[model samples]
Target: MEFDAVLIEPRRAAMIAAGLWLDKTADDYFDACLAAHPDALALSAIHAATGARRDLSWAELDLLADRAALGLRALGVGRGDVVTCQLPNGWEFVASYLGCSRIGAVFNPVMPIFREHELGFMLKHGESKVFLVPKTFRGFDHEAMAEGLKPGLPALRQIVVAGGAGANSFDALLSNPAFDSQRATITRDTRLGPDDVCQLIYTSGTTGEPKGVMHTANTMYANLAPFAERLHMGGEDVILMFSPMAHQTGFMYGLLLPLMLKARFVLMDSWDKALAARIIEGDGVTWTMASTPFLIDLSGAVEDLGTDPASLRIFLCAGTVIPGPVVERAQRVLGARVISAWGMTENGAVTTVLPEDPAQRAAETDGVPLPGIELQIRDREGRPVSGPGIEGGLFVRGCSNFGGYLKRPQWNNVDADGWFDTGDIARMDAAGYIRICGRSKDIIIRGAENIPVVEVEAALFKHPAVQSVAIVGYPDDRLGERACAFVVPKPGQTLSFEAMQAHLKAHNFATQYWPERLELREALPATASGKVQKFALRQLLRDEMGL
Candidate 1:
C-alpha cells in the first residue's frame, strides 16, 4: 500500500515539471467551484424505471457531500480508508464519491451488476472499511446481499443503504442538519493530497484474480485535461452518461472531469435508448462518452424518433474499433462526430481521434496518443518494432500512467523505465497512429464490459463433469465479441449446454460471465509443453461458425 514504491520522487517531480501532474486535488476544485458559482447546475440524475429526475445545484451538491463526509467520519472512517460504493448512477453515487474525496478516503466504486460471487472476493480483497449500496436496485436487494456478506468480511465496518430504513441510511446522512456547521470546512486539515491514492478500481486479470488499479487525483487529472482539450469540451456542453458509474469509462470521464469542468452532467441509471433520446431532446445534451454499442443504439433511436440532435457534437467511443458504416450512420442521423478512443483501467483515455477527424480516419485507427502519454510497438523480444505491416506488442508509459495494482506488487508489470506492457498486438503507420490488431491477454470485452477469461475458466473448472475448459471470444457485430466455452468432459460423462448453465448458476457465477456458446471436445488442442492453443479454438470459431 506504500505508493512511494510505485510513484517515486523522481517521476513525480518530472511529471509536475512537465505540467502533467496538477498539484491541486478534485476536492480543491469542487470547493472553488462552490464558492465561485454556488447556484450553478452541477448534476442531473434520472431514474430509469420511474421516469423521474433530480437536479442539484453546486451549493446543494457540495452541502450533501459535506454532510456525507461528516457522517462517514462519524463512523470509524478516516484518512486513507477505503469506501466501497456499489450503486447505480444517481445523486447518491456522486455524493458518495465527492464525500470520499472531501474526507481523504479512497473511493472504490464497484460495478452495479456484480453479485455475491464477485463481490465477496472484491470486498475482502479491497479491505473495505465502509460499504455503501442501494436497498434494492433492479429488484435485487443489495442491502440484504451485503448483510449476507458481512460475517465473512472482517474489515467491513458498516453497510449503508440508500433507500433502507433504520439507522443505516445514506439519505439520512446527507440530510443530517447537525453536520451543517462544517459545510464549508472541506479546506480543513486532512492527511490526503493530490499525489495520495484517491481511487481504487478493480479490473479483470489474466490470472483469474481481479486486480485493484490504484490511482491518485493527479494521475487521473493528467488524462482528463488533455482528453477534454483534444475534444474541445467546455462548460456550455451538456453530457449524458448512461454507463455504470463504477466502470472507469464513466468514473473518470463521466463524474471526475464534469466536476472539474463545472459543466451540467446527466447520470442515467440504465441504458434505455428511449430515455436517452428524451433526455437528449429535453436537456439539449451535446456529447457523451461510451462504447460502440451506445453509439449504435443512440443513433438508431434518434433516427427512429426523428429527434433533431443539432446540439449534439461528440460521441466518444472506446474499448472497440467502430465500423465505418456505424460512424457514417451516426454522423448522418445523429448530427454528431464519432471520436474513437482507447484506454484501460490502469490508465484513463490514452489515445483518441481529434474533434475534426473524419469517419474514415476514425474507423481506420484508434488515433494518436493524448498529450503526456506515449505508445510504442515492440516485438516478442522486447525490442521496438517498425513499419505498418508488422505487428508487435503495444506498450505505454506516460504521465497518465497509474500508480500500481493494490496488493500484488508483482502484478504491476512496469519495467524500471516505467513502461507497462499493454498486452495488445498493434501496427503503427507513418502518421504515428496505431491500430490494434489483436490482444495477447485472455480477456473478452463484450459490449465494453470485460469478462476475465481465466477467471471464468477457473470457476467452470469446479464443475464435476468438466475435465478441462478453455474460454474464447467469437466476433459479434454489435458487442464486438461474445464468449464461447470449449470443454472436455470427464470419462463416461456427457454435458449439455443447459447443464453447463445450471452448474454455473448453482455456483453463483455472474450471468454476464457465462459463455453464450459452448463446445465439447474429446481433448483440447495443446502444445508439446501442454499449453492450450487458444488460437486454434478462435480459428475454429472463425471457420466453423463463419463468424
Candidate 2:
C-alpha cells in the first residue's frame, strides 16, 4: 500500500505559514492563560498521606514560576541550559518545568526512583547545569544519592532540594524580592518558540542505555490538540495526574493539555487505587491516564469500596497493550471509556480510540491515527507492506514527532524522507485500525518460526490466575532460543508450568505457544511507570536456568 506516498501529502505552503503564525509556544500557552484567566484554578496537588490539597490559581502559579525563573537566571541558568528535576508528582515539579520553559531552558525530568547509575547518565548526556530533587520520599534518601553522585557529574553545577534540611530549599530560591521585578522585565525576546527544544526525555532503556529524546514545543503541543478535541476537554474539565510528569504522556496529555485548554489539574504524589478512586468521585475528576495495571487496581478497589465508578469520563491506558477483557470490564463497571493509546517518549501521544468507534472495534485495535498524523508499515528492507493483517515495522511522520535524541545524533532513526522508525511492529486493517504485534527487538525466534511475544502475553493475561505475565526468549542449546514465561500469579494463587500450560490449552492458544518453562514470582519487577522490566526478568531467567 505505499501508505506514505498516498497518505502523507506535503502541507500547502500557505497553510504551513498560517500554522507557524497561529501555533502556541510553551511560554505563550502559559502566559496567555495567566493573562486571560488569572484567578482560575490551574493546579491542585493532594498529599495522599495527609489528604492535604494545595491549590494554585493561574495568577499564583504564574507568579511562582516567574520567581523561580528569575532565581534560575540569577544562578547563571539561561536559554539552552538543561535543568534536570527529580520530584514526585506535585506543584513543585510544575513550577520547575514552567520556570524552565519561561526562560527557554530545557527541562529534563528524571523519574524519582532513578539511582546514581541512571541519574549520572542523564545528567552527563543532557549536560544539565542544575538539578531539582526531593530529599526523601517513601524512605528513599535522594539527598544521599545526589551527594554520592555529585562528584562524578561534572556538568551538574547546582542542586536545589524541594524538601529536606542542609540543602538550598526551593522556597528560599524564589523568596527574593527582586524576583517580581525581574519577571516584570521579562520580554517576548526571552520566550521559547514552537521549534525550540523544550525537554529531554530519556527512554526506559529496555534494550540498552536510555537515549535522551529531544522534543520541541510544537511537537508536544500538536500531540495534545487532537486529544483535547476528541475528549471535549474545556475550562471546566478537571484532570487528575497520577503518572510521572517526566514521561511524555504525563507531560503532554496530563500537564500541557490542561494548560492549553485552561482546565484545572489535580496532581497526586503517588498512586493508591483507593485514593485515586476517592479523588475521582470526590473532586469530580474528568480525565486521567495510567497503565493497564493501575486501571485494574483502581477498578478492583472501586468494587471493594462499593462506590460507583462513573465520576471519571475519560480513562486512558498507555505504555503497553490493553487486553480486550480489561476494556470490556472498565466500560461495563466504570461508565468511562477505556482509551488505548500507542506512542513513545519520542512522539508524545500519537493514536487514540475515537469516541465514535464501536466497542468491539476499540477492543480489537489501537484506533486510527490522530489528525495530521501519518503511519506506514514497512518490511525490513524499508519497503511498504500491503494488504490487510500484514505485520511489519511501523513508521510515523507528523508535527508531533520529535526531532532526534539529544547529544547522541547517531541514534537518529528517521529515514531520508523524514519518517521515524518506531521500532514497533503493527498491522493495519482496511479500516485503518492498527494492532501492535510486538517490539521488533522483542520478537522471539523459536526454531525458524517467529513468535510474537505480545500475542502470547495477551493470551496468558486472560487466565484468571495470572496477574501479570512477561514472555522472554531464553538461550537454549536445543532450540537455539526458547520462550520462557515469567508469571506473577494473582494474590493467594499459585501457578505451575503444568497449570499454565493447561490454561493456555483451554484458551485455544497454539500448543507451540505454550511457554517451555515457567517461573513463578510473588510480584513482577516493574519500572516506576508500571511497565514490566523484561530485561531484568530475562537476566533472572538466565541465572535460574543456568543458560
Candidate 3:
C-alpha cells in the first residue's frame, strides 16, 4: 500500500548514506526495548481531571498495541489508511499511535481543543478512515460530534469511542479474545519500511488553511538521537509529558522519544501544575519539554508547595522567549536546566540550548540547531543575510524536516538550495545562538498554541454587523499573546463583544480561537492594495497598552 506524501529522492539517498536516516521505525526500537527491559516501566499515566494513575510495563503496552492493531484491522483499517485519534494524554492514545505505526497506517492526531469548524476541514481533507476519540472529554461529547459528522464524511468508515458501551468501544475491541488468537500470524512486515509516511499533522499556515505536515519514520528518528545525546538522556532518565500528543513537540519527544530511549514516561492528560510538581518528585521525572507558561506555573507550584523537585534535570520550553526572572526562579526552585528552544510543525525542535549552557543563555537566545540540521537567515531576495546579528527570515533544511505538505507538493516551498522557509524572523549572534525577533507568517504564538490569526478573522466575517475585521495579538504576561479583534461596524448598525462571540459559536469554532477583546474602529489602516496592515495594528495595541 502506497502512502500519500512527498519524498525527494536525492535528499533521502543522502540522508540514508550518512546514516542519519536510520532505516528503522518505532516498532523496531519498541521491540528492542522490550527485549532489553521487559520488566521495566514503560508508561505511568495520570488523568489530570481525576488524579487517577495507571502504570504499565513495556511488555504489557506491546501486547495492547498488538491487540489494538487487530481491532483496527477488524474495522477495515489497513496499510496507508489515515486514522485520526482525538485523545488526551493517556494509555489509549499511546496504544492507538503504536498500533497505527505497527500496521503502517498514518496516524493523524487531532488536538482535543479543536471543534467542528477546525476539525471538519481536517477530517474532510484527509479522508480519514477511522477516528478515535473519548466518549466524553473535558465536558465535551467527542463521540457524539464524530457520529454527527460521519454522515458528511463518506471516507470516514468507523468511529471508535474510547470510553463507551457498544461493539465499537475501544477498550472492548482491544480486549477481544479473537485478536489474541491471531497473534501467532502477526509478523512484522519488511515492506512497512521507515521511509513510508507514518504521521500526518495539520498546522495552520499564513493563507488561513491548515497544511498537513507528513513525516516518515526515518525523518522523525533522525531527530531523536542527536537531541537525546546532546542532553545526555538515557534509559535511566524519567520523562513527564503534559503537552498534547497532537503537537509535534509532545508527539516526538513525549511519546516516540521515550520508546526509542527505552525509558519510562508519565502522561499527564491535563496540565495541572500542582499535580505535575508532585509527580516530578514522586515519579523522579528527569526530563520534560513544554512551553513558557508551563515552566512558569510549575515553578510557582514548586515554590508554593516548598518542595525540591530535585529529580527534574531538564526543562525544555519553546514557543516564546523565557523571561530572565522566570528562568532564574525555576532553576533556583526546581533545580532543572531551563532550555529555550524553537521549532515548527514541519520540523520538531530544530533549535535548543545546550545542557551545559548557563541560565543566561536561555533568556538571551533560543539556541543553535540540533545535529543533522542547518539554519540560515536570508533576505526577501533569497540572498543569505550578510552578517551575524542581522535580522532576516530564518530557513532550515535537515534530515528531520518533514516532506511536502499533504496533497500539495507545490507547497513544499523549499528553494533550489534546499532550505525551507521557517517564516520566523531571527538574528544569529557570533556565538551561533539565534534570537527570534518576529514572524512573517502573521501568526500569534499564544502560549504554545498557534492561534491562526487569519482564520479567526475569516470566521468573524460571517458576523452581519462586521463590515471589516482584523485580529491582532496583544502581549500577555502568562500566555505570551492574546488575540483582540478590531472591527468596523456596518453603517447604521452596532456590534457588541457578546454578539461577536455568539456568531463564532454558531460557526463551531473552539472558544480558544475566539478573540478575547473587541475594539471598534471607524476604519482600518491598509496599504494602497487594500491588504490589511497587521504590523501597524499590532503596534496600535502595543502603544495603547504602553508595552
Candidate 4:
C-alpha cells in the first residue's frame, strides 16, 4: 500500500532536496554483485549454541534468494504482502529478506526469543501472509507455537519451517521446480521502488502492544550509507555481530550492511561472550555493533579466559548507557575503540560516535546526529529550547526517519512539523553533541528491548494479593538494567516472586517482560494527584543497590 501523501510529501521533498535520499534499493546492490563479483564472501555465521559455522558467498546467497522468492511466489506472496520470519541468525533469514525484497514484499523480522504473546500481536497486526519459524530454537518448539497461532491469524496462508519438521521445509523450497520460471517473472517487471516499504520492525513504547516501525528502502539506505562511510567499512573488514538479527542493530549492520559493502559478516544467534571471543580471534573479526552487556561480557572473557581478540578494532555500543568507567576499562582490556551510539527501530543509527572521536566524547555523550538529520531539544510545552546544558525532550527529523506506525494514526508519535518525539530527555552541548539523561516515558529498556512498564503493572495489579504495584529499573553491571517490581500487598496477604511470575505467565506475557526482582513494600510514594511517583521508586532502588 502506498503511504499517505501527508506523511510522505513533506519528508520526501525535504530528503530529496537535501540529496540524502538515494534512489537505489538493496536488491540493486546485490544484483550488481551477482554480475561483477559473485564469488565474494558476503555472509558467515557461527551457531550461538552448537558452534557450527556456515558461510555463503554472494553467488550462492543470491541463488538461494531467487529460489526462496520463487517459493514465496508459489505461495501467492506478492507486492505489499508481509512475510514474517522468526528465525535465528542464519542463512535462512538472509534468504527470506532477499526474496521478499525481490518480490516487493515487506520483510518483517520477529525476535527469536519472543513467544506466543509477542508473535500473536505482531503477525496479526502486520497482516502477515507467510510466517516462517525454526521448528525449534533454544529448546522451544516454535513450530508448535506457530501452529497454535495459525488459527488466530486470518492472513497467514503458509508456515514455512527451517531445520525441523513442518508442513514445508526451507531446504526443499530451495530446489522447488518453479524457481526458474518465477525468477523470470520477478525480473520481468519488478515493481519495488526506493520509497516502497522494505521492513516493518516492531518495538515497544509506553504502550502495552508493540508498534510496527515502517522503513522504506531509501530510509534504510540513508542509515546504512552514513554508517558504512563513517566507519570506513569495506570488503576487508569482518564484522562480529552478536546482537539478535531481529533487532535493528543486527538487521542493518549484521545482515544488510555487509552485503552492501561486499564485506564478510559473522553472526551468533545467541549471545555468549566466550564463544564471541573465540570467533573474534579465529575469524579475524574487525568490528561489531551491540549493547552494553555484550561489551561487558566480552571484556570479562578477554581478561578471564585469556582470549586474544587483537584483530578486533571497533565496538559500537548502543541499546543502553555505558558507564564511563566501563568504557575506559573496555578500551584498555579489549584493545578496541569503544564507540557509543543512540538510535531506535524507527530510524537506524541516528547518532553515533565517530571512529576518531575522543574516549571522553564516547563516554560522556551519545554523539552528534549524522548528516541529513536534525536534532533539537524542546520544553514540555513544545517550545524550542536553545541551550548548551539544559535538559529537554529530544526530537528528530531526517531522511532515515520512519513514516508512521502501522495501523495506528493516533500513535504516530510525531508533530505536525514532521518531528518525531524520541521520548528521551537529553541535553545538547555547545558543540552539538547529545547526551541522554533519562526517559520522559514510562518504560524500562532491559537488555535493549523495552519493557512496557504500564502494561506489566496493569497485569500485576489484577492479582488478588496485590494492593498496589510499581515497576522500576534497577542498575545491573551486566545487563545495564533489570526490572524490579515493588508491590504493596493487601492486608493479610503475601506475594512471592514465584507466584507473581506464575501470574504473568498465566496472563500470556513474554518472560522477558516479567520483573526479575520483587520487593514487598508497605506503601509506595505518591503525588498529590494520587499517581505513583516512579522516580521516587527508582531512586529508592538506586540507593539500595548502591548504584
> TM-scores across all candidates?
0.97, 0.79, 0.98, 0.96
- lDDT tens digits by residue: candidate 2, 1-547: 0001111123224325646223577677787788889998889998877788889999988888888888888777889898989888888888888888877888888877566646777787778888888878777777777777788888787888877555376776743455786677667777667666777888643334567777776667777877688767787888998877866667787788888888889999877888888888888898898777777777788888877667688788765556677778778777888887777777767788887777666567887888768899998888999688899999998767775766555666777777888888999989887988776666664432335576568778888889888999886533436798888889888787888888776654446556898888888889899999888887888888786
All candidates' lDDT scores? 0.86, 0.76, 0.87, 0.85
lDDT of 4 by residue, 1-547 (tens): 4433135556787788778888788788787767777887777877878888888888888778889888887889999999999998888888889888888899899888787877899999999999988888888888888999999999999889898543487776643555766566668265478887788899887777788888887888888888788888887889888788898888988977877776788888888888998889988999998888889889999899888889898999998888898899899988999989998888888898888888977888899888878898999889889679999999998878886788876787778777989998999999898998889988888888888888889999999999999999987777767999999999999899999999999887878899999999999999998899999999999888787
Task: Give the runs in model 3 whose Cα sits over 4 Å from its true position.
Answer: 1-4
Instruction: Write model 3 residue lDDT over 262-285, tens digit each, in one string.
Output: 999999998999999999999999
Tens digits of per-residue lDDT, candidate 1, 1-547, equal: 2443375354898998999989877887787778878999889999999899999999999888888888888887888889999989999899888888878888999998888888898989989989999999888889998999999999999999998877898866645778899766665576368888999889997987898889988889999988889888888889889999899988888898887787889999988988898899899999898989888999889888887788888888998879989999988988888888888888888888888766788898888999999887899899987566579998999988888888888888888888888888888888888788889988999998999898789888988999999999998878888999999999999789998888888766778888999999999999999999999999998999875
Q: Number of clashes in model 4?
A: 0
- Between candidates 2 and 4, the one scoring higher on lDDT is 4
Backbone-clash count (model 1): 0
Q: Order candidates by TM-score, high to low.
A: 3, 1, 4, 2
Residue 117's lDDT within candidate 3 is: 80
Compared with the true structure, model 4 gives a TM-score of 0.96
* Error in Å for residue 417 of model 3: 2.0
| Cα TM-score of candidate 2 | 0.79
Worst 10 residues of 1 by lDDT: 1-10
